[model samples]
Target chain A: DAGITQSPRYKITETGRQVTLMCHQTWSHSYMFWYRQDLGHGLRLIYYSAAADITDKGEVPDGYVVSRSKTENFPLTLESATRSQTSVYFCASRGTGRGTPTQYFGPGTRLLVL
Target chain B: AQTVTQSQPEMSVQEAETVTLSCTYDTSESDYYLFWYKQPPSRQMILVIRQEAYKQQNATENRFSVNFQKAAKSFSLKISDSQLGDAAMYFCAGAQGGSEKLVFGKGTKLTVNP
Candidate 1:
């Protein structure tokens, strides 16, 4: 495919278990982001990567860890999943930095922690 | 910190009619970017339109358009000739000039009625 793709569209895990959401983009964008969507919060950025081996925390990165070992993949991991982390996670990519490029998003991953 | 606000929690428009979703943001940065994203039941986040703060003219893509008011710090989305496919949750986002993380608003659920 030529677009961004997310794995495990639907996931259900225990509260203390670890879960990882994978995001892969074929465009080889330099910027990749992870966002969590909830009912009243809309979407909140969890983490973002500027390029390979360069990542930063976003608005809601408390329980999530993100790593970008390559330009095409940005994976988000929840070390100890909590019920509060149950939400839909979205991955987006852009060809360049902010203010000069458009972001393309992938199909979200719906995670449920019980 | 930058913040995006979408006051309308929900809205409905008849098919073939026009609908506008209001969005306001708070930021001290002069140069930035604004965006409108659509998420349907499928959970795919799709970019609808984008506007740069420095640009005077509004940005439009097919049936989607934005009314950007820099002075008022408002960026509203106007969907013309609304169709059944337009029913979804629309989010307003803002990105700093040099930052890749996006600050999103509490989305507006837009319904296109037949």
Candidate 2:
């Protein structure tokens, strides 16, 4: 309960439908990231936020949208979910400016788009 | 852009034995961080170990240790006295010093045979 968590552990949606995956962390970490894991392609960063109001795109940000209005919540939205978007999505958080830059991840959200 | 590569897609090790998973990376930046993550069937990403490029000494944690070759741009994880609980998908990831994004390699599925 103290670490990061993701909502809707599993979801099924149709193509062209809009869906959102919610990620929340209790640690109030300064750095939060969203990654999608697929077969043959490990984990690719979709988006990352340095702070509440500061966010940037990562390797695979196309067709995915993210916003960080609050430090604890970073939700990923798929405006038009496609079949290729079906994968396990993960949310991670890490504190910056000290120690090891290790990231703690939450239980992934398995999304299936038909 | 930095790229991490895990050559072995799958590996099997007998219980109480040792297993090594290889990982190679390509990065021009001198200072960076490397990490090994373990994901079990539960789909939670757990940090196994970490090594910084700036440090010449290898990093070890309990049964897990990394043979980090800075000159070869290679990082491999060696798990000693492997147990059944160690059966999972292991991933290699890297992040630049000033960047919040982490580049991950295709994971290796390790099976423990008892």
Candidate 3:
């Protein structure tokens, strides 16, 4: 009752469209993640990658696809963006090297579909 | 299963004052790591501090420090000499020992008033 709780933040999307949110990190962290921030649900992971060319699904991976061709870039594509898919998408990266456990995030993409 | 909690929806402080954002987490892994990230109006997530579960000492970065209570599963960030630039959204995250996938909080928006 005293810490962080998911409140109602919102997103938007068209019925059937494709939207790609791109995340790029300059630090070249070996791990990258994609998350969607919403009210009540909080920040839900869509996908993550440990390195270039390797990826895995997170808690909520449906309607979303991720790819990592380079260490610095991780992109999230909503194959068919429904109105429900409209939300704030974040890209994050973290290094595997010593003294690096925090995942730094990209400027979130605010997607609005009408 | 993994979970991170930030109960505060928003917090306000004056410039030059100190503010602490509370976070808590749950994980099966004993050797986990905790993190605090700041996202300004720019929406870019910046690393604030990181606390490794293996270490007894807390983590510090400049004016930022963490109050890591391992037994309590608490990782709170304390920002001393808060500046106007300190106004932003702060998020708490947790990662397991070797898996490295992160579980995040909904976030708390910090407002630094002059």
Best candidate according to TM-score = 2
Write down the lDDT that model 1 would get: 0.91
Question: What RMSD, rounded to one decimal, does every model reach?
Answer: 1.3, 1.1, 6.3
DockQ of 2: 0.79
Docking outcome class, model 3: acceptable
Per-residue lDDT tens digits for candidate 2, residues A1-114, read 679999999999999999999999999899999999999999988999999989999989999999999999999999999999999999999997646478899999999999
Which candidate has the top score in DockQ?
2
lDDT of 3 by residue, A1-94 (tens): 1111111223465868876676777775788988887766667888999999999999899999989999877878888887777778877777
Ranking by TM-score: 2, 1, 3
C-alpha TM-scores of all predictions:
0.95, 0.97, 0.85
Which digits, one per residue and each the tens of the lDDT, describe model 2 over residues B13-47? 99999999999988999989999999999989999
TM-score of chain B of 1: 0.98
What tens-digit string does per-residue lDDT give for candidate 3 at B1-114? 888999998999999999999998988778888888787877667777778899999888999999998889888999999999999999898888777677889899899999
**Clashing pairs for predicted structure model 3, backbone only:** A3-B6, A3-B7, A3-B8, A4-B6, A4-B7, A7-A39, A11-A86, A12-A86, A12-A113
Q: Sorted by DockQ, highest first, which candidate order results?
A: 2, 1, 3
The predicted structure with the larger TM-score, 1 or 2, is 2
**Which 10 consecutive positions of candidate 3 chain B have the poorest summed lDDT?**
B41-50
Q: Find the candidate with the highest lDDT and give its number.
A: 2
